[model samples]
Target chain A: MTFLNRFAGLRLYAVLFVIFIYGPVLLLPLFSLDTGLYPTFPLKGLTLQHYAEMAANTSMIEALKNSLTVAVIVSALSTTVSIPAALALSRYRLPGAAAVLGFMSLPLLIPSIVIAVALLIILLKFLGVALSLWTVGAGHVLICIPFCMSVLMSRLEGFDPSLEEASRDLGCTGWQTFWRLTLPLAMPGVISSLLMGFVVSFDEFVIAFFLSGTQTTLPIFLFSQLRFPDKLPGVLALGSLILAGSAVLVVLAELLRRRGAKSANPGDI
Target chain B: MAGYGLLSPALLIMVAMLALPIAALVLLSFWRQSGYTLDTTLTGANYARIFGLSDSPTVWMGIPFYLAYPVPVILLIKSLMMSLTATVTVIPLAYPMAYFIAFRVRSGKSIWILLLTIPFWTSYLLRVFAWKIMLGYTGAINSGLMALGIIHHPLDALLYNSGAVTVVLAHSWVSFAVLPIYVSLEKIDRSLLEAASDLGDTRWQRFRRITLPLSMPGVIAAALMVFIPTVGDYVTPTLIGGSGGSMVGNLIQDLFMKRNNAPMGAAVAIVMMAVIALIALLFVWLTGYHKMRARRR
Candidate 1:
């Protein structure tokens, strides 16, 4: 009945919401451990056969390699691009910063499918550019920019601007100040942006699906495997592995960001 | 000058990757594609087919009549409907989670937010694919029921329907929906709620009068956030959506990749984007989110 405590039902809803978000994804790992080919109930005993098979699958390994390469490139490129933009936004009163920021976040609002198709058109039809890992990486970078910018912006904004100014007043050049003070302070966000960008590109399917040629990413390979019932268990194994790896990386990134924020503005994080 | 210098690289990339490419796609939509070569001539024929420029139409709900090639238009409508359904379901379910974390959680709100963010940063493909496993023919739901002697046959209705697509979208996007709403709720001044309570207002009355209106920006943002992206989603509809569940994304994919009709595909993509933009702008105008900032200024 109290204003602060009328959420007895809400507490229960929160628990169920967490379950709803995680329960389906957890099913992949649960079924991966089962011996049954189908992801059904009533376990047919536990087995690690699918993991072994996934390890031995040469095609899947090649796709995983390609995905890793693209993800690495995407993470580096997107983060590198975002650092300056985030710095500019955080430090300066740029003209129309809000509108420019909104414009940049356009990729987040538009469908990845539309991005994919449009890129496919431009690359193949207009630019005469071939569909390769480069195009896929480009798509990933566009999608990753808004996220990476926010991460770096938060980190840069949290720290006192006085530090950078102090470095500047000490006769350090702008680039020197950025290198010696700004970049170091924003390191946590830089790393977080890199990891998140990597996970996004690695698991991205639609953009790569539309933009790729002979080269395929792990997700594209997994999607292709979905057609065969025999590959179901292995697909589940791969999916579960991706899910787990992403969770670990994201949690680590979030913790690092929080730690950076806590140190920058003690007590808020 | 320094700010612009620093920002130019990111702005350039967006122009190269987004603006230029989309413009090309838009131009290509006007040009005809016959075989491998694109005819340099611009034409409205592509747009014409979508809006029933020729032939008698199959009318639905006494509106959205299409006489020729109604597939793209129909799928666009279907995808929008499914996305709205998902958005509606998510707001109600997510509002309470957001509300709980905002109003109830005292010390560890960051932990709860982190929990929500973790799923969001994970593979969207894997999350949706997981739903396919749970909702498939011999999926967990049916298998569990059969195991418990509750059913003689696996239920086919659980998957391969618009309902399946809607449910998956709701689950996958609930995390994103929660954080914004949570932030908005957390930002509310406690004094206002206290003010209401002191006036002998009920908790529900306080929420309805103060909390709901204050959080409208987040709710509207959350709705557009989920609805816009999911409307053009390709993976969910294709992987599990059977015939009945295919959205505009699937149709676009088919036109370009399978059918090799890139111009037609471009037209469909443009149409989908236009409709989404209209709806988004209208929603913001209706809710006055866009004007609220300027009004405050």
Candidate 2:
């Protein structure tokens, strides 16, 4: 009780910090609702004209499709590849475990622009691969795997080995034990990883910018459209929808993370 | 062996997708560039161009002078300074918020964290654009000021400068700072603070001696999380940054696309990575990260 009063000033700062963080973004939805062509102040009137225009834009719909496809493939690939690696890192006292972990996390430390440029060069020169959604997915997987591994490692690390032993004693084979026990235990972690990975791939711009071929991601399309003043309202409308969708996804992911934290061991994500 | 087998596919992907490409980037940095094709011959010309150093030695009275730096080198240094400024600005703001959530909220901590992260979940491009809209001459800030009769003319200095880049980047990366700091604050043993208070230490003294030292790891992590990524940020500078606010990343993109110089771009990328790694190492050393890791072990 005394502690709360001692630092009562902090609550004000926290509120201000929240305002500072979200003020610009929250204004986005307000402007989207304004009938004004520009997202400036003194809105003309409330209307859904921008949203209607956004709905009618073929390029916007196509970009959405491309983004979804890239995001789904990247999420699946990242989680699938990370599961075994996370298992090995958590369960075994492997040689060079620290080095392996460090290497896996290198992408997070380096600039995304560098990663994008490096991947672009590698695909173009060494592999003779063309710039496509597949290439973007490849880069996304490279970056997203580390995130997936971090979440899965926490879930896997806390598993009771004795549970597997008990299952085996009950005549369960390796595959059956994994299916019945291990998967269910780690399901929350897996879900969070998938959702977070999807979000990362969906919103990522740099790699998609470089690796995008004829079909571009939503970010790339939005970026190109930013230069045109006339496109501002419609883009804001699209951005508002995306903002709402992302908020839901992030909330779901956080809820899953909390559930995993309660049921499994508490891990600082 | 089975563990090794389990790790192989991941290792393969990392090597193939990440390590090998970086290696190729370094190699390409050295390779000579001709009209439109890169020569197989290895040369140090790209490095020389990136650093504004000349190979020819013309020592006048034992004093050495180099050629003028290319534009990208200047932008790289500017980017480093701007990113540092933004990281420094965000630390003070984020620390208080993280402290509040960790110690004050008590319950519904996750909800606070979720609210903080809501901005990040949305498109980073749009968030930066949002700042652009707010800062533009005819945008929110100017109009609000005019409507309130605070100022007659629109403020021209509100956007398209290094300062605007710093402000937007700091805001965009605040969640990164808050999360790490919150985690570290949570890890601190509450009884330690109580014990400090019980020893007749004032609140400031207890925070300085106990809480601050304990949270150094998170502070350093937060700093790195914000600093490293913002240094090479292309979007913020591109939209709100105008000519004066362009970064190393914007230059690198131009080097590849507009100038048709992949070798130079690769060299710039390599230099940027090396500079970031050096800064990170310095930060880790100053924060006693090695000692912290040892103590944990």
Candidates in order have lDDT scores of 0.88, 0.87
Instruction: Provide the clashing-pair count of each candidate structure.
Output: 1, 0
In candidate 2 the C-alpha lDDT for residue A110 amounts to 84
lDDT of 1 by residue, B92-209 (tens): 8889889899989989999989999888788888888888989888999999999999998998899889989998888888789998898789888899999999999987899999
Q: What are the clashing pairs of model 1?
A: B57-B67
Across A209-269, the per-residue lDDT of candidate 1 in tens digits comes to 9899899999999999988998999999999899889999999888888788779353233
Alpha-carbon runs more than 4 Å astray in model 2: A1-5, A264-269, B54-66
B198-266 per-residue lDDT for model 2 (tens digits): 999998999999999998888888999999999999889998899878889998899888988899899
Per-prediction CA RMSD (Å)? 2.0, 3.5
Cα error, residue B140 of model 2, in Å, equals: 0.9
What DockQ number belongs to candidate 1?
Answer: 0.85
Please estimate how well model 1 matches the true structure, expressed as its whole-model Cα lDDT.
0.88
Name every residue pair that clashes in candidate 2.
none
